[model samples]
Target chain A: MNKPLAAIAAFAGLVFLGSGAWMLAGHFRAQDAVLVEIVQDGKVLYTVDLASEEDRSIRIEGADSWNLVTVRGGEIFMEEAGCPDQTCVKMGVLRAENLPIVCLPNKLVIRFADSQEVS
Target chain B: MKLTTRRLTELALLTAAALIIFVIELRIPDLVPIPGVKLGLANIITVYAVFRYKPEETALIVLCRILLGSMFAGRPSAILYSAAGAALCLIGMLAVRRFIPPKWIWLCSVLGAIFHNTGQILAAMVLMKTAVIVSYIPVLLFTGCIAGAFTGLCAQMLVARIDRKPPA
Candidate 1:
């Protein structure tokens, strides 16, 4: 009811609504995009066409950690990680455009490329 | 700032308590796959200390906790991200403290969480050197708000209870 409380509430509301909308848009827009990139330490290690790539696994080694990136049946997922948290492995699959599969400890990122970037 | 023996002891105790909470929270399975998302239960102490102690004192406790916590977790690599998030969160909460009375400490906590998320994302971008990392901003912000509110509300209840008790 107080002014500051009201302001805080309004600010949180805006963030919640805006983020929710952005995430939704990102998810919907992610469909039909097949190009996925595997990046580590800011460098692109591999850029594969998921829709056309063969079912194979790529082992990416970082400075102190490693990740097993697998593409199966046209879907990409982190099969394993040397890091303890295993967050990237649990990310299941690279689904949303805005949500990349990340392993902070290993400094690895697996994300879908922008559709425009597709050749 | 003159830190009397009693003040020093109090800060040390708060830091230890926060470190314990941080370690315990690590045991909890990741609620989501995102790198920066968590309950951040240790921040409850930070929120309580922000309102109860001087800004410099609160900063000391947080810094100590982050250093010790990284060692305990055996994830030295994560120290950078944790430090970035904690520093931004502390500064933001300290500045916002003036507007929020004890009753609304949760609001300050929420704002602090936002700052913490921003710091983590920025650190990730710089360290990863990838513009694609920007895509994570929305999800991290969304989760940060929830985690921040939870920790803030816990700290608010803690403050209420501690204030009700007469100083011994």
Candidate 2:
């Protein structure tokens, strides 16, 4: 194999290994309270404690679209969206710290809040 | 960039082909729920163009594809993410092409994918004004590598088959 090709292969291998480990760490990380924040256009619209919050839905209106965030059974997921691609809705639930349910068109993000951010 | 008529026509044709691919791929169901995870099949044309044309010419094709693609998809907000990703991907591929032979085009494509994901994360960070999105980088990179290899292999095969000269 050529040197450049070998180098590229090595780089990709390292990236895969590193990223795989990172994601696994996120997955296996311990949890305290399941606090999630609903943010639109960088503003915190709502923060709900899934552990105690009742089953309810929040509607977020963006500049050009909308999203329905729902919490049920102590899980937060996108229930509906006005955007063409329902990627956020399909994400199912917010689990990993690294992976946030995102709706780009609506500029909405549903993610677990860092414990420090809680007050 | 001095564009001969033939070069201009080829660029236009490639742009159209990329737009069509972009629109068609939109019909495919989400392979994963993540926002940035995609096959990015339109990038096959991009990879082919990066190897076949000058950097500026390749850039033009990519720009045209993104602009027209978002319009057709009716998702104007997506244009920002796509444009940033394409720009970084193009620059990375173009720079790395010198080190990579045509036979190993997939390597360049993988690098491009990494750059593309980085650009997406950067755009998301700026737009969302939160570094929390940085956490998605690992997942995006993992997926980008796989998708990039597939599209790269497709481009490599096209490079092998197509003659550089236009048929008159």
Candidate 3:
């Protein structure tokens, strides 16, 4: 009801609503993504054109861990991960543009890249 | 400032309560697979301690909870992120404690949560040697705000109902 409380509430609401919208927008935009980039510790380890790739499993190994990145029918996901948390594995798929499949412990990331020429 | 018997006892009790919450929360399935998003239900005690106790005492309570909580959760590797977030959250909450009125406990908690997420991401960046972790900050911020509000409200109610004035 007061000024400070109202201001706090407005700020919180703006962040909550605005980011949610942005994330959702990103999700829809990713549906059109055809290039998936694999980066490790900030370097582009590999880039695959999802539209052209046949069903295959790529095993990515880091310092002391590994992630079995699988591509099936043009959809990419972390089918298996050696990290303790398995967060990236549980992430299911790389379907969102902004929300990358990040295995923090392994310094691994699978994200939708800009090249969208899916044939 | 003096660590009287009653004060020591209260701090211990609060730390124990927070550890319990932390352990219980560790059992809850992650709502999202995002690294930084969680209920963070244990933060309820930190928020309550920030308002009810002195800064020094609050720090002790948070330190004990984080250390013990990590042990109980069986994630020793998590101690770094948890400690960084708790330190930042405690400092920010203590600094802002003077301005925020009792009714805006949720706001204070929200700020704490933002700082917590920032610290976690920063730690990740340094430890992982990659800026890609920054991508999670927005989602963490948004989720942190909601979770903070819930825990803060719970703390606010608990603070109001149970009256224990600190010694002057």
lDDT tens per residue, model 1, A2-101: 7866887788778877988887787777377789988888888899898789999999888888889999999999999897777788889888777889
Clashing pairs in 3: none
Model 1: per-residue Cα lDDT over B1-168, one tens digit each: 889898899889989889889989989999887788889999999999988888888899998998899888877888899899889999988876778877778888988999998899888888888877788889888889889999999999999888743222
Candidate 2 residue lDDT tens string, A15-83: 877888887888888766488888887888898988789999888888899988889999999999998
Candidate 3 similarity to native, TM-score: 0.88
Model 3 lDDT per residue over A1-119, tens place: 66756776677688778767766665566267789988887888888888888999989888868889899998989999875667788889787777888876667888887676655
DockQ of candidate 3 compared with the true complex: 0.49
Cα displacement (Å) at residue A68, model 1 = 1.3
Give candidate 1's iRMS in Å, 1 decimal: 1.5
DockQ-based CAPRI category assigned to the predicted complex of candidate 3 = acceptable
TM-score of 1: 0.93
Q: True interface contacts reproduced by each model, as a fraction?
A: 0.68, 0.70, 0.48
Residue B25 Cα positional deviation in candidate 1, in Å, after optimal superposition: 1.1
The interface RMSD values of the models, given in order, are 1.5, 1.5, 2.4
lDDT of 3 by residue, B1-168 (tens): 678898899899999999888888877888988876889998999999888888999999999998888777655667888889989999888877777777888888988888898899898888776776676777888888889889999988888887878435
What digit string (tens of lDDT, one per residue) describes model 2 on residues B8-37?
Answer: 998999999999899999999988878999
Ordering by TM-score: 2, 1, 3
